[model samples]
Target: MSERVVNPTGRGFLLLDSHPAGCFATVARMRAEAGGDAAGPGKGPVALVVGSSAGYGLAATIVGLARHGIRGVGIGFERPAGRRTATAGWYRTIATASMVAEAGGDFTFVNGDAFAEATKAEVLDLIAERFGGVDHLVYSVAAPRRTDPATGVTHQSVIKPLGAAHRTRSMEFDADGTAALREVIAEPASEAEAEATVRVMGGDDWALWIGALAERGLVNDGFRTVALSYIGSALTAAIYRDGSIGAAKAHLEATAAGLTDRLAPWSGQAFTSVNGVAVTQASTAIPGLALYVGLLRAVLGDRMQSPVEQSVQLWEQLTGARPLDLDEQGRIRLDRWELDPAVQAAVTERWEAVTSATIGEHADVEWFRTQFRSLYGFDVPDVDYTEPVETDLPWPT
Candidate 1:
């Protein structure tokens, strides 16, 4: 699509493409969300974001800068620059960074790994040099490959159920909007894989960043730390749980405890939010998750489905507002709203109605496709997707 309609609600973000045109369109979208005005946060915040290119990461960054006028420093690696599907979220980030700078908030990007001790040190050094110290830290890194500094070996994670067979219906992006029938994939994971997955997605990396901040004295008073987490419906339990990633998240929840407790004396608090899912490159690859999330979006009301709105809602409700709604276990429940009793009941009812023998006749296929295409900045109504995208993605650059 030529012009992407950014979500005005401001809860999170809905990404267009990584194209230069796409970037311009996204800034337009964000501005529109901000009521055709540039965003600022009083004096603004010194913000640091990992995975700040697309999905929730980008949304959080944009909200931090565009809505609050905070200057941000982004740290993460790019996906070798070309190839759209199995790629990097950097294009969106680059465009957004440029947009933020033009809007008057500084946005410096660093291409680096978050899992490495060296990388954390480097980010700390930069923060000390540039913004003094970050008032807010957003850690949203999602990596599949992590290297063991001690062993010099690389580990790759898989998205299969742990032990039993998991049945799930998925959106076949290739098929446009139709739900593709397939048996849920199940594979065994080793202890090493499980541990590695925890190391990569869990809270160790987050803790490392915090520790680094503390060491550099860059963590300001009452600094806040947020990391994203998820707990889909029971249907996703197997692939998510026994799966390589879920185990990591379990550790992540616990990691928040450790970090929060550790940061307590300094008046810093750690909170994790379960965010609403809009289509993203990373979410698209998940087996049944695409269709599930797509249908979930179609069924959810207007405001909740809008990523930008969602991010704003998140900031308003969870971040910097009142104390976040942490469970007795000290975990926040952002996504729980999406999975609330009424919401889940509706989604379940809707899923059944749309998954029958002749489901197409009853379902809204148009909406389904729109959601999928919107993930890549295609099929957006306001944008003219034709005439070749002129936007730069830093591929050849």
Candidate 2:
């Protein structure tokens, strides 16, 4: 192993490297902020979290261990190969595991493709030997493509509208590191592409996991499962809420009832949790979301909630520590703050008035940039980037 200074690489929203110290610091900070005070060694609930390496999934794992004291198993697809560093999610999950162990809690991690049947079997066997049964299941997988285990077919998800072309104002970074707004026109997806997106992003895998758990008798009464989703404002409807992603989300949401019905035998339940807007690896890739998030932050200021905050609330609802807040379709709505009419109105005003020249005035571009950098384990507070650090840190025990 060699030591070297690692700076943030990649342009725009995509990142190429992850910093170990920065990722550890982020997990520590989030755990502290999201109710780590309650963490202790005890017999808490058991949770199996799919996609538990980053974003809301990472937050859920942190909250479960640090706040709710849950014995947890996390599944993620990440690489920590020869020369290059592991993905940010890998570091984050390792950090979480380290923190949980320090707190005298149980947290295991499996790094592999969550959609694969062998992965499912390994997870199930581990659960059987370690936790006996899982009390909660958190599904938050986000990927560009998923290979069907049965059919051996890979379906790639695309971010385009279903029926009509859409034009939206988005942001791009300049060579000098200045961000500028640009017009992005997205053409409608073909029928095959739309279906493929659904196949990749929808609830099929979630349902499969549940079925596997049930087949192994790994669910008991009062068991709960949650899948994370987002429903943005009308400002991004064409590219988000009404786009092919939205179709996949709709399928995910609709799958909840079926999952609940399937779990009825054990008095278990499943629901989609509509989470708040936050900077995550997935959000950075969506068209227009960066700009919309910046404006939303500028308008809402401290009222906006991060993924950890929303996840803490989700844990409260799931564990019956707080009353469930469901929408008309019986799904949890943790995005109430983002969807507040006043907040949306203010964001809309900023979205209409803002331009490249006035972006700094109307949008929290700095905040957006900071959050985005934090996702890849950069720009974190008190990190010593000047020092030569090991890129390939061992996964925490």
Estimate TM-scores for all models: 0.84, 0.98
Which tens-of-lDDT digit does each residue in 1-397 have in candidate 1?
2333222111112332333444456645754674424355236767788877667777777766666676758875766433232133555656676676567667677777877778777777888887788777887877788776657767776676665556677645222224454445555666776777776778876887788788778887777788887777764567774577888878887887788788876788887877666666566666766556655665664635455665666565434655566667776666665777887777677677665454444334466666554554555456654546533245321
Residue 70 of model 1: what lDDT?
Answer: 67
Best by TM-score: 2
lDDT of each: 0.64, 0.89
Model 2 score (lDDT): 0.89
Give candidate 1's TM-score.
Answer: 0.84
Residue 287 C-alpha lDDT in model 1:
74
lDDT digits (tens) for residues 85-114 of candidate 2:
788887887888888777888778998899
How much is 117 displaced in model 2, in angstroms?
Answer: 0.5
C-alpha RMSD values across all candidates: 5.4, 1.1
Model 1: how far is 119 from its true place, Å?
3.2
